[model samples]
Target: MEPKPASASRVEVTHLVMPGDANSLGTAFGGMVMQWTDLAAGMAAMRHARLPVVTASLDQLSFLAPVRIGHMAILVAHVTAVFATSMEVNVEVSTEDPRTGERRRCCDAYLTFVALDDAGRPTRAPPLLTESEDERRREREARVRRASRLALRTALTGA
Candidate 1:
């Protein structure tokens, strides 16, 4: 069977921070941000793969700022790269203030997800159809990001 098709636009998911999702300081926990990352990335992956998918790896996650209780956390995910059975999804998390409705970036990450079959095994994803200049541009930019990641990894491991 063929894989499903990815959306040309982004998939944005939003969550509100309640008491349960906070830390002792009443700020959102990093683990919670990570969980949202996986969820948003998986959605983007499903769009890219046209099938159910699972996280293969999270290349990097950086928390730039803290999210407070009563803040609205939004995740925006987009397809960054596509391989035979996997696709890289980039997710950005931002927080909106409750009173003034101000928004600020909180975190960003790159996650790779692999399509799965009914048995929950890896399966081939659909080839990305770049129908617009924007898609081509995004793919190119993703390649650059991937190269930068590899270089950084090599430097860190001295490999």
Candidate 2:
């Protein structure tokens, strides 16, 4: 398959935080935020492969700030790198202040998704092409993350 630029698989989603999705503290529930983060990552992976994808793992999920009810939660996801059959997706989430229109990053997450064929077996995803400096940097950082994951897995399983 031909390589595709990162922009081709970039996805941005915004949702209004509701009271039903928040905790007693009036901040968005962690589960609710994770749901949106996974959706954004899944969309980006699907766009890159044009095939059905399954989430392999979620890494480095951090809740940096609170998202209040009635605020807008914005998430941006993109393919940082494509392995043989898996894509590494990076998601950045922010909260928008309705009154002042200010935005502050609230979360950062990394997810791995594996493309699947019609028979449900893992399939190769198109290579990710980096066009800009930022994209290239992301790709490089993704490589390091991948290495770290493998190292941890090997240490735990002795495989």
Candidate 3:
């Protein structure tokens, strides 16, 4: 497969934080944010892999700030790295106060997705081309995170 630039698979999704998606405290629920994050990340992975993809894992989800109802939640996702059949997607979430146009960083997450072949087996994905310092940094971070996840899985499964 040809190497594709990170920008080729980048995706941005924006949504209004409705009342039903928030708690009584007026802050958006974690699950709602997670759903949006997953959707954005999945789109990026699918673009990179050019096939159906499935979520393998989610990592480094840190909710740094609260996104209140009536705010606009924005999630940006891009392919950071590709290894064998899996692609690493880095997602950043921010919230904008529509009235004032003020934005706050709310969450950061790394999602792993595996592309599937027609037979439902893992399929190799195209390599990621890091075009800038930021993309290179993300690729390096993705390697470390992948190692850590593998180590944890081995420890848990004794495999």
Which one wins on lDDT?
2
* Root-mean-square deviation of Cα positions for candidate 2 versus the true structure, in angstroms: 1.1
Candidate 3 lDDT by residue in tens digits, 56-93: 98985789999999899999999989999999998999
* Candidate 1 vs. true structure, TM-score: 0.81
Which lDDT tens digits does candidate 2 get at residues 111-158? 999999999999999999889998888899999999898788789889
Ranking by TM-score: 3, 2, 1
| Model 2 ranges with Cα > 4 A deviation | none
| Model 1: residue 4 alpha-carbon error in angstroms | 8.2
Q: What is the Cα-based lDDT of residue 18 in candidate 2?
A: 92
lDDT of 1 by residue, 1-159 (tens): 443334663689989999899999999999999998889888788766668998766776678889999999999998866877778788889999989999999988887788899898888877776667876787788778767765886888886
lDDT of 3 at 2: 87
Off by over 4 Å in 1: 1-9, 131-134, 144-159
Q: Whole-model lDDT for model 3 versus the true structure?
A: 0.93
Model 3: ten consecutive residues of lowest lDDT = 150-159
Off by over 4 Å in 3: none
